[model samples]
Structure formats: C-alpha cells, structure tokens
Target: MHRVVVTGLGIKSPAGNSPAEAFATVLAGKSAAAHLPALLEAGVPVTFGCQVPDFDPDVYFPKHRRRHLDRPTQLGIAAATDALADAGTPDAGRPAGPGTAGSGTAGSGTAGSGTVRCGTYVGTGGANIGLTADFGALPHDKLPVATVPMIMPNTTAARISIRHGLQGPCLTFSCACASGSIAIGEAAMAIRYGRIDRALAGGVDSMLNPFAIASFARISALSRRNDAPQEASRPFDRDRDGFVMAEGAAFLVLEREDLALMRGARIYGEVTGFATGADASHIVQPLEDGSVAARTMLAALADARLRPEDIGHVNAHATATTYNDRAEARAISACFPAGSPPVTATKGVTGHLLGAGGAVEAVFALLCADAGLVPPTANFTGGPDADAIDVVHAAPREIERLPVVSNSFGFGGHDATLVLSPR
Candidate 1:
C-alpha cells in the first residue's frame, strides 16, 4: 500500500478564491453570508446566502468552449487548474507510459505520458439537475444542442479528465453534501491501493439559483435572518436556526508520498485516514443518538492508526441546524468520552456549501493544521449542548501540532470524514 499526501489545493468559494485569501478570511471570523437582491425580490423566506465574490467564468475558461458546460463544471475546472498549477505540475516532457516500470507516473512528471496514469475524481449534488431544471424552464427549442451532455452529472468529471488528459478512472460521486469528502476519501483509497498513482479529487456545488433557494425555503431548511445575514448561521448556538444555502468549488492534488518527496513538492499535509458511514435511520435527520456518526469518526481514527486522544481538534460539519448540531455534538462526545477537543465550525461564516462544503472545509482543516491556529465559529453562543462540547468561538485558538478530524455529513444519512495530520 502507498501513503497519500496533498501536494496542492485550490478553492473557489464564498470565503475567497485562493487558499491564502480564503484561509485568511476564515481566520478573521467574518461571515460571508449576505442578502441576495434577487432572492429578496422573489420574496424567498431566506434571502441570504454565501456566494463566490466576483465570479466571471470568462476568466476561467474560454467563453466559446464553455457554452455547454454548467456553472459547477466551470467552477471545477477553475479550481483544478489552480491546484495543478499550485503543485507545479509539469505540462509536458515526461517518460512514456504507466506501463513503464517506475517511470514517474505518480503525478510527479507525466504530462507527456502516452498512457497517463493520473485520474479525475470529483463530487457534486444536483449538478446536472440544477442546470437542466434552469434550462427546462425555457421555451422549447431554446435549449442548446448539447443539452444531453450538459445534464449528465458525470459531465464535470469527464470534462475535467479530458481537459487535463488524465486517462485513469473518471468518476463522480453524488452523495449529497458528503459528496465532497467522499470524493477525497475514495480517491485516497484508490491511490493507497494502487488503482492509480495520483488524482485530482474534490467537489463543486451551486444552490444559489433562485429556484433552488425557493425550494429550500419552502422546506424551511434555510436561515430566515434576511435583515442580518452575517449573524444568521450560528452553528451550535442555542438560537441557531437553519443552514444557509451557498455555492462554490474546491479541489486537491493527491500524490504518492514517495513520488511527492522525490520530486521535492511542497506538501501541505498527509491524508492519513478516511472513513464513511450512514445514519440509515432517517433521510434528512441524522440519528439523534449519533451512533453512526460516532462509528464513522472512530473508524477514521482507527484507519489513521491513532487513538481517540490523538485528535487535537475537530472541524465540525456544523450546519447550524438544530438536529445536526445536537447529533454531531453527541457523536463527538461518544468518540472522545474522556473529554472533547477544540471544535470549530466554518459554516457559521461560509454558510452551508452543500456538496462543496466537505471539500472546502477539508482544505480549511489542512490549512488550519499548517497554520497552527483554529479559527472561531461565527456567531457561536454555545447552545444547550455547550457543556458537553467546547465550541471554539470569539477568537482563534493556537494549537501548533496534532491531527484534525474534518467531518461532513449529508441529507439521507451520508457521513464521511477525513483525518489530516500536519506534515
């Protein structure tokens, strides 16, 4: 088995575009949620959401070529492009094929390989459905000629693979919000098991559209603090309402540890362990007892070959919803029965990113480890379960060393986690 490490990271999120900018923004503890005029004009109960600032696809992809690609796909390409560049991926001039024994195929230098060994793995929820629904509302014959291709969930993965010439397995995981973390976890497994040398793995999602917001609002899943959008997403707070719908994308370049070291790549951190499970008891509600969530965390810890005490901190999935926060609090208590570690929830600031939430939070986790600081959870006031779980709020806490468990659970019982240790 091979060890996997993150050689590069890219993010296009409500917080910020570049990793440095995003991390800085998060550390400052500022809320990205704001009222969208369109939503307010439509009378959506919840008009506030976190949106990527100044998004212009023309800068990311050629306008002519991107006519058929959906917003999520475009965002994915932009993040992936930044990641590959961050890793300083060689564009050309490399040994021939993966068939050649030890010919630099572990994302070290394979841009010119005849049989590229790099793979593309990504995740998104309602990717195609979002675009299709939007176009479906248009008049007949007004849709583009490539409507079929645009509506395929796999379009993101396929286009990413084609654009970068990664010939390995192209996969798309659409398991709701857990989709992002699952993509990262499963891709690491592929590398560990030698299915491929390396992969571009992450997730992208967009629910900022008016229709999606209206549906979520109708279901009462969004925060209703239209007047004070910044103070709305208070994860773990006693007065916490509902999650804020947001959109963005994130990606990571996972490479074999040995290859990354040999090529002298700057390693952010090592992806030591990843595990996933399901609530199974409810569709949208996490098992109130948190048994499944606890098991998933323990499983990830076990996979990382670490005891419960090894986790220095936790990056909670904390959507600020009452049910999820309570369940996750119980689950964390179960994992660390002795005492809880410092926990921070970025959703308070970034809002609930849905499919992109997990990946973006994972990036934040690794960056937190690298920076030796844990950012505060925005608008946190210590909810009823506060005594049981020490929610980090108000300001950042310094913890220079140790592993962090980043959790991402989704509607319909999906739960996925990653254990990252600073390198």
Candidate 2:
C-alpha cells in the first residue's frame, strides 16, 4: 500500500479564501460572523452567520454558465480548481465554466506524462437546498429548466472530475457535518490501496439561505445572540448558546507520498490516519457519554499506529452547543492523557459550515502542524467543563513536530477523525 500526503489546499471559507489568509485569521482569533443582509431581509430568527466575504462567481465561472450552477457548486468548483492548480496540475485548454466536456489534456485520461491517475471526491450536507428553497418561493412556471443539474450533490464532484480530467473515480459523500472528513478519508484510502494515484477531495455547503437558517433555528440549533454576531459562537464558553450557521467550501489535493516526492510537489503534510463511526442513538444529539466519540478517536489513533500521547494538538469539533461541548469534552478527556495535548475549537470563529466544517478544520489542522502553532479557540471563556482538557485560547500555542487530530461529529450521530503529521 502507498502512503498518502497532502500536496495542495484551496478554500472559499468564512475564515479566508487562501490557506495562509485563513490561518492568519484563525491565529488572530478573529470571528467572521456578522449580520447578513439576506438573512435580515428574509426575517430569519437568527440573522447572522460567517458568510464567505468577497466571493464572486464571475471570477471562477463565466456569466453564461454561472446561471446553471448553485452557490455550493460554484464554491466547490473554485476551490477544486485552485487545489489542482496548487498541486501543479493547471487546467490547460479547459473551458471557463462547469459542465463543459473536457478537451485536450484537460479531458485526457492521463495528465503529467500519463503517470498520474487522478480522481475527485467531495461532500455536501444538502444538495443545493438553498436553490431548492428559492425554487419553492418562485412560481411553478418560472422554475428554471436547469434545476436538476444545479441541485445535485454530486455536481461538484462531477465538475471537478471533468475540469481536471480525472478519470479514476468521481464520488460524493453526504454524511451531514462529517461529509467532508469522510470524503477526504475515502480519497486517501483510494491512494493508499493504489486505486488512484491522487485525488481532489473536500466539502462544500452554501446554506446561508433563509429556509435553511430558519429550519436550524426551529430545531434550536442556532445561536440567538443576534445583537453580538461576532461573539455569538462562543465554543467551550459558559455563555455558549448554539452553533452559528455558515456557508463555505474547502478542498485538498492528496497524492501518494513517493509520487509527490518524485514530482517535487510542495507537501503540506501526510494524512496518517482516518476513522469514522456513529452513535446509533439520536438523529440530532450525540450520546452524552461520549463513548462513541471516544471510540472514533481511539480507532483513528490505532489506524495511525500511534498512541494518544503522540498527539500534541487537537482540533475539536466543538460547535458551542450545550450538549455537544460537554460530550466532546468528555470524549477528549477519554482519548488523550491528562494535561497533554492542547485543544482548540475553530467553530467559534468560522461558525459551523455543516458538511464543510470537517474539511475546513482539517485544513486548519494541517496548517497548525505545518506552522508549528495551535490557533486560539476564539470567544472561549471559562465554562463549567472547559477545564476537562487544555483548551488553547487568548493566543496561539507553539509546538513542534507532533501529530494532530481533527475531529468532526455531525448530526445523526456521525463522527469522523483524521490524524495528521508534519511531513
């Protein structure tokens, strides 16, 4: 089996568009949450979220082709394109929009001398649900004819596959919040087992629409601090309410370690381990005992052939909800030794990207390892169980050459973990 390494990353996230920019924002403990005009105009109960700033679809896609794609697809395509380019696979002779048939090397089965086999795997929580809601609000006769193509969750993967001429496997995972992590894990596994030479994998979700926010609000899953949007998502804080809903996309290019080295690719880090499990308990709430989450972490560590003490930093799945923070705290305590690795939760700044959360956090985890610094958990204050683990806040914490674990626990009890190590 081959070893997999991350060679490239791209993001259109609430934190930032580029990995360096996002890492800087996270290190500074900045919150992207803010009042959104669309939410306010729609009269959503919660009118704030971490929306991606300065995102222009026209920059990635042509005006004529952008009309047929949904917001998530647009974000996904942009991220995937950037990721491929970062991996030294430029889209030569490719069209300016998605859904176009591949031409020349872009459509050829082989790229970079026919030695590399590439594929695409992406995840989304809802398949263009925001667009679906828009269609529902419009008259039946006025519905766009391109609805099917625009709304499919697999459209993002398909676009990436076509755009880069990846012919190995094009798949999509829809495991709610764990979707992105699972997709990335599957891609790494494919490379490890020689199914593909490399893969573009990540997650995307553009659900900042009124219907989506209102639905989450109805379920009591959103923070209510509308007046203080910047502090609304206070993960691991005593005053925490619920998660803030955000929309964004993140992608990474994974290649076999030897092949990346052979091509002299700029390796970001190695994906050492990945594991996923379910609580088998509730659809919306995790098991309070955190046993399932603990098992997930243990399994990931085992997969990496490493002990708990080897982990020097943990990127938590803390969403700022009451039950989630408590349960995850217990899980973290159960997984690692006492007062060992520093823990940080990024959702306090980026808000919850649902399916995209895992991918974004994974990127942050890689950046932490690469930069040898653990970003602060924004808005964190002393909470009831915050002492269960060492939560990094106030400022970035520096460490060296230690493995990092990024965890993602989604609704419906889905839990995913990824273990990363410096290259």
Candidate 3:
C-alpha cells in the first residue's frame, strides 16, 4: 500500500487565501464574518456572512475565460492553480497556461518527468446558485454570451483537469458539506491503491445572494447577528445562534510520500487515516444519540491504527448551530471515552463554507499537526449550556502529540473524518 502525503495547500478563504495566511489568521482568533450591505440592500433577511474578502477573479483568469464561470468555480480554479504551483508540479501554471496560459492536457505533470498521472477531485454543496435562475429569467437577447458551462456541477474539477493536463480521473463528490473531505479521502484511496500517484483534491462553494441567503434563513440555520457579524458564529458557546454562510474554496496537492521525498517537496503532513459514514436517520439533523458519528471516528482511528489518546487535537465540524454542535460534541465525548482532545471549532472564525468547509478545515487540521499547537476557537465563550468538550478557547494551547483529527458532517446525514499526522 502507498502512503499519502500533502505536498502543497492553497485556498481562497475569508480568513486569508494562502494556506499560511489562513492558518495564521485563524490562530490569531480573527473572525471573518461580516455584515454584507449588498445583501441587506437586496432585502436578504440575513445580511451577515463570511464572504471572501477582496477576492478578484481577474487575478486567476482573464476576462475572456471567466465570462461564464460562476463565483465558486472561479474560486476553485484559483485554489487548484496555486496548489499545483506550490507542489512544484511542472508546467502547472494557470489563470494563464500557454495560449490560454493552461492546457491541463497541455503538458506533463511533474519535475524530471517520471511516469506520473495526476487526478483532480473536487466537491461542492451545490451548483452555481444565481446563474441558472438569472439565465432563465432573462430574455435570449439579454442572456450572457458564455455557454451553459456555468451551471454544470463538475465544471470546477473538469476545468482543473484540462488546464493542468491531468490524465487520471476527474471526479466531483457532492455530499453537501462532506463533499470536499470525501473528495480528498477518495483521492487518497486512489493513490494508496496505485491508481494514481498524485491529485488535486478539495472543495468550493458560493451561495451568498438573496435567493440562497433567504433559503437558509427560512430554515433558521443562519445567525441573525447583522449588528455583530464578527461574533455571529459562536460555536459551542452558550449563546450560539447559528452558522454564518460563507463562500470560498480550498485545495491540497496530494502525492505519494516516496515521490514527494524523492522530489524534495515540502511535506506538510500525512493523511494517516480517513473514513466517511452517514446518520441514516435525518436529512439535515444528525442522530442526536451520536452513535453513528462515534462509529465513524472509530473507523477512522482503526484505519490510522491509533487509539483515541493518540490524537492531540480535533478540528470539530461545529457549525455553531444548536443541533450540530450538540450532536458533534456528544459524538466526540463518546469516541474518546477517556477524554476528548483539545477541540478547535473554526466555524467560529470562518463561518460555515458548506461543501468547501471540510476541505478547508482539513487543511487547518493538517497544518495544526505540523505546527504542534492548537489554535483557539474564535469567539467561543464556555458556559452552562455549552457541550462538554475540551474546546480550545480564549487562547491557543501547545500540545505534544502531532496527530490531529478533523470532522465534517453535512446535510443529508453525511459524515467524514480524517486523521492527519506531521511528517
């Protein structure tokens, strides 16, 4: 069996775009949630969310290329482009490749050109939100000139494959919030089984307009804290309201450990274990009993050959919602049995990126293992009603063990967990 390791990490996130920047920003306990005047002006009941700050598509793609690309697809392309570059993947330049500044099928994948085939796997909560509705509403003459590629669910992964010339499989996983983590896990499985040596895996999501915001608000799953956007996502807090919707993307360059070492790539951490499961009982709500969630974590631990005590920290999938935080906390307590590890619920800072949340938080988990210190949960204020977990709040804490576990439970009862350890 092959060992999988992360050679590069990239993101277009509200905290910061680059992996280092985002990790540092989260560690400093800065919440990126903010009030969107545009949404409010559009009469969106929930005006606050965690929007990517100052993101520019013009930087990732020329106007001609991005004409039909939706907001989420643009974010995905930029993230993948950056990840491949950071991994030292040869000829992986984009936003510009050759004539288009890319050929995805344009060139060979790595340095020294050893036999290698790279794959692309991405996940999304849903397809472009506004494009289809707008196109349907507009007259034929008023519609944009770009083709219908804007509405395809697999557009981001397909575009990444074509631009980088990846010959291996290009797949998209759509399991709501677990989409990104599932994509990454499946990519690791492909490498471990020798189907592919390298891959770009992650997630992307954008649902920030009135239509989507109103949908989430209608379900009462959004924090209605427009007056205090920064503190809106208070995961595991006594007064936690609900999640703050966000839009962003994150990608990681996964390659065989032997290949990465041979090529002198910077190894962030190894994906020691991964497992995904479902509650099988609810559509949006988790099994409050936490049985299924606990089993999923145990399965992941068995895959990594580690016990609960071996985990130094946990990147909890605490969306700050009433049900999710409570259910996840109960699962954590059940899984550990001995005692829960230091938990850092980052939604308190980045809000909830939906499909992209898993991949983005996975990146945070891997980096946390590499750094050997757990960042504090942004805005968490422990109190009587908070779940009984060792939530890292108030300040960051140092830890001795290096392995970290990241969890993601999506709508439709999808649950995924990854065990990452420093190289």
Q: How accurate locally, in lDDT, is each candidate?
A: 0.86, 0.86, 0.85
Candidates ranked, most accurate by lDDT first: 2, 1, 3
Q: What C-alpha lDDT, on a 0 to 100 scale, does residue 25 get in candidate 3?
A: 86
Candidate 2 deviant stretches above 4 angstroms: 92-113
Task: Provide the lDDT at 98 for model 2.
Answer: 32
- Model 1 lDDT per residue over 134-208, tens place: 788889889888988888888888887777767677899999989999999999998898777778899999878
Worst 10 residues of 2 by lDDT: 98-107
Which should have the higher lDDT, number 1 or number 2? 2
- For candidate 3, the 10 contiguous residues with the lowest summed lDDT are 97-106
Q: Candidate 2's residue-wise lDDT over 21-65, tens digit each? A: 888999999899999999999898999999988888877888998
Worst 10 residues of 1 by lDDT: 100-109
All candidates' TM-scores? Answer: 0.94, 0.94, 0.93
Task: Compare the candidates by lDDT and give the number of the best one.
Answer: 2
**Candidate 1 residue pairs in backbone clash:** none
Candidate 2, clashing residue pairs? none
